[model samples]
Target: MGIKRTVLIDEPFPDLFCGLCQGEFWEIDFIPVLVPHFVFLLLLLLEILDDPVQVRCPEDHMFCSSCIGNYLQQSRTCPHCLTDLDPSLFQPSKFVQRQIGRLRVRCPYHEAGCTWQGILSDSHPNEDR
Candidate 1:
């Protein structure tokens, strides 16, 4: 293998966000930190499951929620690791949550003619409120 290939593969994605950051993240800012995943849960639900669904395997790999959600419907075992799982085991990804929150998404009621486009947090209302 060429040195160039190794060098190129060593760097992380430029726009990678760790799901908890309220703003953009650079590759250098990556440091595993303890972040609460609750408040971000609602936001996770609203955001499209474009990123990997949070799985509780020994290895922390990402999976698209929709992909895993659908997969879970057919089999309780994780497709990637074949670990037995329950619906509750499939947590929403924190990184994906923050990434989605940063995205300007249409209101959930957009199809109902609500013209709203902004961060997911500001776009949706608290149903309990």
Candidate 2:
């Protein structure tokens, strides 16, 4: 609960994108403004990452747990560096998870007329979405 600020979607934040799907690592509360068409497409593809995991590489690349798990089953190598990977060594990225949890996002039903927007982790299933 620091400064409650909103981020414009015009600038790209590389760390916010998932390595596997190239989609946003978390949904964001978008401001109503005139943005480029591509930005809208990117927003449309936004998804709340499930079980974010960090790869055991120097770069510490991250991917959704399911994505990395499935990829490892096919090839036991880091997707970014092609280095040998040990599935057992993979661990949930608690730091990244916390960061994502702090993000502000509109309700999943925002497009369906829900105006609720707040901290992602604070959103509850019983919300009036």
Candidate 3:
């Protein structure tokens, strides 16, 4: 048997990728040249995303819970203004959260016979969810 070399990745990377959501979907800031026609529309759509929670850093900037969590887990500072962060400052944006919980998105495993289509509050993945 051949020995397998261990590869250590010390950089941050996305934890999951689902082909169902266009795993490499278009990001507003990094739009491709082939998608210029829908640039403005995509930008507007991104600006209108109703993420439920707002994590307020010491700089008073607004961020989604996921964003803040990712940042804090790496360092205890704000990524934008470089201000120190206190996780306790996070607050629930009730209305937006409610709206988000009401929007129905297809399951990431839709191709695998999952007919469970509904709003996702915490985005947890399980066989029955």
Each prediction's Cα lDDT score?
A: 0.41, 0.54, 0.37
Q: Candidate 3, which segments miss by more than 4 Å at Cα?
A: 1-53, 58-74, 114-116, 121-129
**Local accuracy of candidate 2 as per-residue lDDT tens digits, 1-129:** 111122323333346445555433443445565433321111223443446777787767677787677777789888778988877778787766666666545556655665666665674553652
Ranked by TM-score, the better of candidates 1 and 3 is 3
lDDT of 1 at 43: 21
Candidate 3 Cα deviation (angstroms), residue 22:
17
Which is superior by TM-score, 1 or 2? Answer: 2
Give the 10-residue window scoring lowest on summed lDDT in candidate 2. 36-45
- Winner on lDDT between 1 and 2 is 2
Worst 10 residues of 1 by lDDT: 1-10
- Clashes per candidate (backbone, < 3 Å): 6, 0, 0
* Tens digit per residue, CA lDDT, model 1, 1-129: 000100011212322222221222221222343433322221212223355466787655445555566556678775656777766776766665565445334443444575655544452442222
Ranking by TM-score: 2, 3, 1
Residue 58, model 2: Cα distance from true site in angstroms = 2.1
- After TM-score superposition, what is the CA distance of residue 109 in candidate 2 from its true location, in Å? 2.8
Models 1 onward score TM values of 0.37, 0.64, 0.38
